[model samples]
Target chain A: MTNLSAELRQYLIITASYWTFTLTDGALRMLVLLYFHQLGYEPLQIALLFIFYEFFGVVTNLVGGWLGARQA
Target chain B: MNIGLALQVVALGMLMLPSSALTVAWVMAAQGLSGIAKDLNKMSAKSAIKFLVTDNAQGTLFRWVALLTGSKNALKGAGFFLGGTLLVLVGFRTAMVVMAAALAIVWLINLIALQSDLGKSASKPKFRQVFSKSSAINRLSLCRLFLFASRDVWFVIALPVYLAATLGWEFSKVGGFMAIWIIGYGAVQAIAPYLTGLRAGRVPDGRDAMLWALPLAAAPALIAYTLNSQFEAELILVGGLLLFGFLFAINSSLHSYLIVSYADRDGASLDVGFYYMANAMGRLIGTLLSGWLYQVWGLQACLWISALFIVVTAALSISLPRSGSTLPTTQ
Candidate 1:
C-alpha cells in the first residue's frame, strides 16, 4: 500500500466504497420488496414502498452536486 | 462518502425493528435515507474519476468509466440475489442486521484511509452552477433522463409483476431471472467499447448515441407486437427482454462514458451530479408510470410507454454534438 502512488490508492478506495455501497443498496431493495410481499401487501402497495426511495434519489442528485462542490 | 456508507448502515438498522413497528411509513422513511445515501456515494465516486485520469486519454476514460459502471451494476444484481436468499434463509431482520454491520465496517475503513483533498476546486462553484451551463451537457442530461426512464418504466414494476402473476413464476425464480439479466447486462456494459467499435480506435459520439437508440426503440414495440399476435408469450418475453437488455446495456455504457468525457476538468461533480439528477428523475417518473400504466393498461401499455420514451431519447440524441466538434458554451 505504501509503494502505490497516491492517485492509484485513492481510486482503489473509491471503487471499493462504491462496490460495497451498491451491493447493500441492491440487497436492501430486494429484502424490502420480498419481505413486504410475504406480509401479504398488495403488489401496488409494495411498489408504493419504493416511491420515497426513488423520490429522494431525485432530490439527492439535484442538490448533492452543490454539496460536493462546497466541499471541493 | 464515508457519511454515505454510514447512513446506509443506519437505514438498514431502521428496518431491523420489530415487525409490529415496521409500518409502510417507517419503511418509506428508511428507504428515503438509503436512497440519499446511495446517490451521495455515487456522486462522490463518479466525480473522483475525473481527477484520476490525465487529459487526452479518451480511450482510458471510456474503459475506466465502463468498468466502474459495469461492475457496480453486476454487484447490484448480486445484491438482489443476496437479498432474496437471505430473506428465505435468515429472514428479514437478521438480514438487515448482517448488511448494516458489514457496511459499518466499510465506512470506518473509508473514513480512516481516504484522503481529504481529492476533488477540491480552487474556486467554489455557486449554487446555480449545479444546473450545468453547457448545452452539450444539458442535452446529454435530457437524453439520459429519458433513456433511463425507458428502462425503468418497464423493468421496475411491470416486468417483475408480469413474470410473477401472468407467467406464474415462483418468487425465487423471478428474483434469480432478474439477477441474471442485470448481471448479463453489466457484463455487456463492461465490454461495450469493443461492441461499439473501440477496437478500431473509434469512440462514440452523439451520432452513435442516436444510431444505437434506434434499434433499442424497436425492441419493446416488437415484443408488444408479437405478444398481440398470440405467439407463445413466455418465449417472446424472455427473448425480447434479452435483446432489450443487450442494446440498453450498450446505450447506458456509452452515456456513462460520454458524461465523464464532457464534464469540465475542474469540479466535474457539478455536471456529473446534475446529469445523475436527471437520471434519478427519470427513474422516479418511470417507477410512477410503471405502477400506473401496468394497473390501467397492463404490461403491453407499459411497453408502449417505454418505446415512446426511447423515441424521445433518440430524438434528443440527434442534437448531441459529435466528438471533437466545438459545442455551444451556453444553454
Candidate 2:
C-alpha cells in the first residue's frame, strides 16, 4: 500500500511538472504573437515568427536525439 | 473501423469540448498520434508487403491498406473543414478542445483495433544488448540522422521562405497555401496504397521501386519554381505540393522498409524513438537555418538549397540496403 502510494505521488509530481512546462510554453508563444501584432507585423511576419520558432525546435530535437542516442 | 464510425466519434467529441481547447488539443493529439502512427505503419509494412506478395491471401492486405489510407485522408480533410467552419461559427477555443477530444477518442479506438493485429512475440533486443554493441548503435544513429535530414527540417523551413521572398506572398496567403498543400498531400497518401500496390507487381525488388519513384516525385518542385506569375505560381505550387505529397508517401513507405529491415538485424525499438528525435532535431536546424538563409540570400537561394537537399536525399535513398524481414519489437 505504501509503495503504491509512493508511485502515485511520483506520477502526480511528473504530471504537474509537465503541465507547468506546457502552460509556460503556450503562454510564451501567445505573448510573442501578441507582441508581434502590437509591432504592426503583418500576418506573414507573424507566420514567419512561428516558422522561426519551429526552426529552433528542429535543432533542439536533433541535438537532443543525438545526445539521447549517445547516452543509450 | 469504418469511416462513418470515426467521423461520428469525432463529431461527438467536437460537440462536447470547447472550441479553443478543441483546436489546440486536436493539433497536439494529432501530432502525437502521427508519431505513433508512423511507428505502427512502419511495423505493419512487412506484413502488408507479405500480404501483397503471397498468392491467394484474400486481398485482405490491399483492402485494409486502402481503408486505412482512405479513411485517414477523408478524416483529415473533413477535420480541417469542420474545424475551420466551427471556428468561424462557434469560436476558436471550442473548436480546439472538441477536435482534441475527438482525436483522443479516435486514437483510443485505433489502439484497441490494432492490439490484436500485433502478433505475440519477444522479438526486440534489450537496451543493454543494443547499447553494448558499437556497430549496431552507430548504424542505427546514422540511419536515424539520414531519415531526419530527408524530411521534417528541410521542407518545413525552406518552403515558407521560398514563397514569401520569391513571390511576395502575405503570411495569410502562405498559410492558405500550406493548408491546401497539406490537404493535397494527405489526399495523395490516402491513395498511395492503391498506386504502390499496382506498381509492386512490376518492380519485383524493393530498392528499385523506391529509386525509380524518387526523382519523378521530386520533379514538381523544380517545375513550380520555374513559374513567374502569381496565379501561375499558385497553380504550380499546388501541383508541386501534390507531387511532394506523393514523394513523401513513397519515401515514408521506403523508410519503413529500411527501419524494419534494420530492426530485424539489430533487434531493438530504440531506433523508433531515435528516428523521431532525429527528424524533430532536423526540423529545428532547418527552421533556424531557413530564417538566416532568407535574411541573407533571399527566397530563390533557399529554394535552390532545398532542391539540392532533396536531390541528395533521393540519391541516398537508392543506396539503403535491404536486410530486415520483420518488425522490431517495441519496448
Candidate 3:
C-alpha cells in the first residue's frame, strides 16, 4: 500500500511534467514559423521548408518509437 | 487501412496547399512531439503494471491515470482549434513566434516537473530488441507500409490540385476545407470513448465497429463532387466533414486498441519510431504521388481516387482480427 502511494506520486509528477512540455513545445513550433517568415521566405518557400521539417520528423519519430519500444 | 495511416495521408495532402511554412512546421512538430508523448505513455503503463504486480492498489491508481491520458486527446483537439484559429487571425508569423515561445516554456516545465525516473534512461533495452522478439509487430509494420504506399500518393498530392481546378477554390479556401475536415475529425475523437460504449452491444466487437463506420467515412468527399452549385457543394462538403469526424472517432479508437493490446499481450511496446516511420513514409509517398496525379489527371479524377483509397482502407479494416473490446490496454 505504501509503495503504491509512492508510485502514484511519481506517476503524477511525471504526467504533469510531460503535459507542460507538450504545451510549450506546441508554442515553440509556432515561434519557429514566425522566425522563418520574418527571414523573407515566400509562401512556396515556406511550404518547402515544411516539407523538410516533415522529412526530419519522419526520421526522428522512427528513432524515438524504436527507442521507446526497447525501453519498455 | 489503419486510421493513423489514413490521417497521415490526409496531413501530407494538406501540405500541398499554399499554406505558410509556419503551419507546416507546426504540424510536423506536433507529429514529432506526439511520437515522444506516446512512448512515454507506454513506458508509464508498463511501470504501473509492474507496481500493480507488487501491490494491487497501485494498479488501480495507474489505470485511472491511463484513462486520464486517453481523455486528454479531446482537450488537445480543442487547443489545436483554438490555436489554429488564433494563428489565422493574428497572421502566420505572429502565431509562429507565440507558439515557439510556448514550446520553450513547455520544455523547461517538463524538465522541472518530472523526476529523473520519467526521463529516458540508458538502461532501457536496445531498439532492435523491441522488434526482434515480435513477429506481429513486423507484420503490422508491413501492413501499414503497404497501405500507406498504395493510398497516400493519390490523396495528398493529386487531390488538392483536383479540388482547385474542378471546384475553383483558392488556396486559402482549400486550407479552410482542410481545417474544417480536421476539426470534424478531432470532434469525433473527443466523443469516441463514450460513443463506443453506447454502441458496444449492437456491434459484435471493436472490429465490427470499424467495419460499420468504414463506408460512411467517404460519404462527404463523394457527395461534395457531385454538387455543382457553390452553396450545394459547401453543404455536401460539410456533411462529409461531419462523417469524417464520426468515422475517424470510431476507427481511431479501434486502431489504438488493437496496437496497444498487441503490445501488452506480447509484453512489447509498439515502436513509436516504426509507427511514425510507416506514417512518414506513407505521407512522403502520398504527397509526391498526389502532386503527380494532379499534373496528369483532372481534379474530378483525383476525388475519385481519394474515394477509392477510402474504400480500400475500410475494406482492410474489416479484415483485422476481432479484439474483444475497444477499451485501450493500459499496460
Q: What TM-score does chain B alone reach in each candidate, compared with the true chain B?
A: 0.79, 0.51, 0.56
lDDT of 2 by residue, A1-72 (tens): 675454334333322222222222222233233333334444344445554345434433334333334433
Best candidate, DockQ-wise?
Answer: 1
The local lDDT score (0 to 100) that residue B12 gets in candidate 1 is: 93
Q: TM-score: which candidate is best? A: 1
Expressed as tens digits, the lDDT of each residue in B246-278 for candidate 2 is 666655554444454455555544423345454
**Each candidate's DockQ score against the native complex?**
0.54, 0.06, 0.23
Model 1 lDDT tens row, B1-331: 7767877998999999998899988988898889878877777677777667655377976787667876887899888878877887899999999999898888887778887755322233445654576667788888989988899888887887788778877666667777888998988886788998865677677888999999999999999888888779889898898999999999988887677666642224453456758888899888878877887788999999899999999999999867644432322
Quote the true-contact fraction of every model. 0.68, 0.06, 0.21
Candidate RMSDs in order: 4.9, 12.1, 8.6
| Model 3 bad stretches (over 4 Å) | A1-17, A20-48, A52-72, B1-68, B88-90, B108-114, B121-125, B129-210, B213-217, B227-231, B258-277, B283-302, B314-331
TM per candidate? 0.79, 0.49, 0.58
True lDDT of residue B228, candidate 2 = 42
Which ten contiguous residues of candidate 3 chain B have the minimum total lDDT?
B1-10
Query: For candidate 3, lDDT tens digit of each residue in B19-67?
Result: 5543546555544444444444434544433443354566665566565
TM-score of chain A of each: 0.72, 0.64, 0.60
Best candidate (score: lDDT)? 1
The CA lDDT at A5 in model 2 is 58
Taking all chains together, the TM-score of candidate 3 against the true structure is 0.58
